[model samples]
Target: MTSTSTSPSAKFLTAQRSELLSRRESYLADMARSTATALELTEDGANQDMADEDGFGEGDTLNVERDRLLVVASEAKERVAEIDAALARVDAGTYGACEACGKPIPEARLEVVPEATLCVNCKTGASLRRK
Candidate 1:
């Protein structure tokens, strides 16, 4: 879907693109940090002697933290992918249109979520369907 007269302005699109790029960079950095922390936790756990008095509980705690960090990294990676897709849409001249309904997404919504691909109604329906 392409933008219409009522769609976001060129300036708005440019700003959104810049914002998306910045967010993508941030997300990538977050992913790297989280992954590194998870790796460090894994290595630390591996080096600890299993026969220590408190080793079992400490290892379990480290494992939980490592798992949480992994999840954070994965979520950041997904956000980066979404930002990339939004940048592609900006380049393709479809940045402000809903991908599912081909409607002009409200500027307010775009302002809040530049990477959104669907209008609020479509997104709500999709979310419901997912459940």
Candidate 2:
């Protein structure tokens, strides 16, 4: 394999790293906003009021909406962590290498999931093993 700095794949990986960093920032911001909103609602006793009014349809709706936002925030937080790991891999010169088999992960797969640590075949095999 060529030195990472001289490889064509290095350019693509560099771009991916930039994109991932931007996405991580967005996810962090979203998580922060969501958490703040949730905390504010909690402090204002909105959840308590909604719970007490559960007999009414409005409370149920509010509860469902709150749950959805929380879920979104949780997912964003998870993605941010994944992006962090991906960045680490990029810095370590292993961003596009499969962790399981040491093969080059396909560009298509990396485009869709830059945090992936396995090539398609290895990933499939691992999944099958799990079953």
Candidate 3:
């Protein structure tokens, strides 16, 4: 995609891309660690063969912890995916624009969420729909 040299949005996105990439890497590392921890916890929970009911509570706690870890990993994975998509938009010269309405995303929103592809209105609508 051809990008105009004078476009402030393009420049801003280019400047922010490196930071987003760094964040994406961090998220990926976190995901790996969380997933590994979750898997280990799950295995440990499953392998507990204690016949005593006293140990059952501990096993349940382990399972709950494993689930929490898995949720963290899942959220990390989603963040990575969002970062990747944002990077793609940067490459396509469409960064800082809302994907839903084709409007320019506000600088404030971009600063808060560099991977955001929707403006506040669109995002709010989508959030409400999800609820």
Q: For residues 1-131, could you state the per-residue lDDT of candidate 1 as single tens digits?
A: 68557568888998898889889989999999999999999988987745575698888999999999999999999999999999998898878888888988998898899899999999999999999
Arrange candidates by lDDT, descending: 1, 3, 2
Error of 2 at 77 (Å): 0.7
Model 2 misses residue 54 by how many Å?
Answer: 6.8
Stretches of candidate 1 exceeding 4 Å from the true structure: 1-3, 49-54
lDDT of each: 0.90, 0.78, 0.84
lDDT of 2: 0.78
Give the residue spans of candidate 3 off by over 4 A: 1-7, 50-54
Error of 3 at 2 (Å): 14
Per-residue C-alpha lDDT of model 2 across residues 1-131, encoded as one tens digit per residue: 54643222767878899889888889999998887776665544565575675544655555666677788899998998888998998888778888888878877888888778798999999999999
Top candidate by TM-score: 1
Question: What residue runs in model 2 are displaced by over 4 Å at the alpha carbon?
Answer: 1-8, 40-56, 125-131
User: Between which residue pairs do clashes occur in model 1?
Assistant: none
Instruction: Please give the lDDT score at residue 25 for candidate 1.
Output: 88
Kindly indicate the candidate among 2 and 3 with the higher TM-score: 3
In model 3, how large is the Cα lDDT of residue 58?
87
Evaluated against the true structure, the overall lDDT of model 1 is: 0.90
Q: How many residue pairs clash in all the candidates, one count each?
A: 0, 0, 0
Q: Between which residue pairs do clashes occur in model 2? A: none
Better structure of 1 and 3 per lDDT: 1
